[model samples]
Target: MSSIKEVSLRRATVADAEAIAAVRVEAWQTTYRDMIPDTYLDQMRVEDSFLHWKQILQALPAAGDRVCVYVAESEGHIIGFASGMLLPEAKFGMQAELTAIYLRPAWQRSGIGRRMVQKVARTLQAQGAESLLVWVISGNAIARNFYEELGGVLLHEQAFSWDGMDLKEVGYGWRDLSVLMASVNAMPTSSSVH
Candidate 1:
């Protein structure tokens, strides 16, 4: 097995949009291969995704809005990214949502994802968000397990259509930011892949 390298997490910038988008697309292709339709995955274009991310990264937040994007870097290359914002309409009583988190396949299960989530949680908490929620593709067992391991509680499920196919999403919620924060903090700092 290849050894994991140290990863540094930092706020994402406009310049990082392309890399972030690439990571997102690659992750989707790998993680959702069986869960999503092949045509949809095949049509996912990096340029389109890059433009979307660029717009999101460049947009100015409205009053009372709390949006953050972060990227994980190792050996001077971006390996993953995560983004979150305060939810306008709280779901499951959660004030914030983890909009997205994606890592390259090789870098997964290396403790980088947990660190990204913890950092996003702390950022959200600082913005006055008391609780957090994340939506995962219902059939994605790996993702579901990852959230559960991080203390997420299954709160709800919703149906949606993708590429003419019906799909479901599972919502995972943390009712208290403090509990999540404390648990993340309790982990040894050395546990980081670095």
Candidate 2:
């Protein structure tokens, strides 16, 4: 981490759709290479992601599944992003499902991912989400460790099929979103570089 002075987190705009899509595609390749099929990754279309992000950006704030996307910008470029939504049937009163979280491959271990996830927790709590939950491919040891180090608990493991392969995913959860927030908020702000 370079100790950047300013890393801004702001609500994503429609203009950010293309950038967001690029981040997703790149992150997916770096983070899910072995977990997902190359065929699936190969077929991923930026057009699809553009359309998806466009819809998300255009939705009214009150729309139930309308995700609140946040981008972490440094030096006029987006290094990471996070997306989350309220889960209606959550075991906890108001739980948020973290749909996606990704940082550029070059930015890993720079604490940007940690900051983004913490921001997501605070954003979700403000929206009445009492808990936070994330799904990770079971084989992804790196991601599992990251969440665990961030105070997430290994809740359960479930099996599903993806790309015609049997895949098992692990669920990591924060029963109290505040806990997650505290961990993120307590971080040294001096980590960000300008």
Which candidate achieves the best lDDT against the true structure? Answer: 1
The TM-score measured for candidate 2 stands at 0.86
Of candidate 2, the 10-residue stretch with the lowest lDDT total is 185-194
In Å, residue 54's CA in model 2 sits off its true spot by 1.2
At residue 107, what lDDT does model 2 achieve? 74
Q: What TM-score fits each model?
A: 0.91, 0.86
Writing each residue's lDDT as its tens digit, candidate 2 over 44-113 gives 8778888988888778355633367888787788777888877767743337888788877877777778
Candidate 2 regions exceeding 4 Å error are 1-6, 60-66, 91-94, 162-166, 186-190
Minimum summed lDDT over a 10-residue window in model 1 is located at 185-194
Q: For model 2, what is the alpha-carbon lDDT of residue 169?
A: 90
The TM-score between candidate 1 and the true structure equals: 0.91
lDDT (10s digit) by residue, model 1, range 81-160: 98899898888899999999999998887767888888888898998999999999999999999888778899999998
Overall lDDT per candidate, in order of appearance: 0.85, 0.78
